[model samples]
Target: MKFKFVALVATAVAAQFVAPVASANDQLAQSICAYVADNNKNNLRKTLSDNRLRLKAVYDGISCDGLPLVRFAIKNNAADTAEFIIKQLPGSQVAQSGDIEWANSNGFAASPILEVIKARSAS
Candidate 1:
């Protein structure tokens, strides 16, 4: 009976640790969005590889006004998170556009992401 009780406790503890690891393709994007919103850059980076589809999901999933992931991070006041997201983008992804007019109209023009986007858009 004591052995059985110990096994049950061990299983419950393992379940707690295992719950956050979501690998299903269908749920990956949403999970990444949650991590980004929470400003958990380490988990966000782990959830999104350089894989095209994952990157696209990260691009599309984390947004409040059609903003890119980095913009969302900046808007949420997560500069460290924003930096981590910016490092993930490259090539065509670097040129990926967000809602500049929305940021401008919403008075996010001073945001770090907005500044970076404007600089890139300039030339």
Candidate 2:
């Protein structure tokens, strides 16, 4: 009975520590989404820098309204953010992610960001 109580207490303590970390991550993601939506590149960069996060490192983990970062930017007509994100990503990743194809299929082919993606992929 004592052992079980100790285990339960330990579990509760562990959960208290874990919950804040998860919430922090959620808050960070929300901030990123908001920044992207607003096309506020400076704030976005500041947030990532403050968190010691490289955009490329966290890119795959983030989705804005269920769309990947670049796609989300395109959807929101955040051209500056979209181009910035595309340029930060590796050319191979940009090409292999099929963003160009997705954009064409989704009627985003006219977006100038597509040109940026193509250029980045070529380089």
Candidate 3:
């Protein structure tokens, strides 16, 4: 939780620089990332749906903490949101597994997000 807070703050800080240098793709990514960070499920879904043709950009835009949108959904307890993203981006299962390694190395191995990732991958 503390890490999530810190990540959000860092995202806010980084957003300042990111806004100026961001290309159209980066801007789109940033917007989606912001929605995920804020747990704005409705906006995120709309944004994602609107940019369905730009799936690569959506996948590239990670949260301020470098977390994928699915992890954000897990942290926010937004199971439906997570499910939607998981279905939309099946390749993220590999990324989620990588996050588990990162969490273990970074001392957050007990995170519920990891459990959710594990459960999803098991299915």
lDDT of each: 0.63, 0.90, 0.64
Q: Pick the candidate with the highest TM-score.
A: 2
Model 1 lDDT tens row, 38-63: 88887777666543445544565555
Candidate 2 segments exceeding 4 Å error: none
How much lDDT does candidate 2 score? Answer: 0.90
- Candidate 2 colliding pairs: none
Clashes of each: 0, 0, 0
For model 1 the local lDDT of residue 47 reads 62
lDDT of 2 by residue, 1-123 (tens): 999999999999999999999999999999999999998888998999899999999999999899899888887888888888888899899989888898889989898888888899998
Question: What is the descending lDDT order?
Answer: 2, 3, 1
* lDDT (Cα, tens digit) per residue for candidate 3, span 1-123: 999999999999999877776676677777876776666767877886786654445464466456766655555555555555655655555455476676577676666666666665666
Q: Estimate each model's TM-score.
A: 0.53, 0.95, 0.55
Two-way lDDT contest, 1 vs 2, winner: 2
Evaluate residue 107 in candidate 3 and report its C-alpha lDDT on the 0 to 100 scale: 70
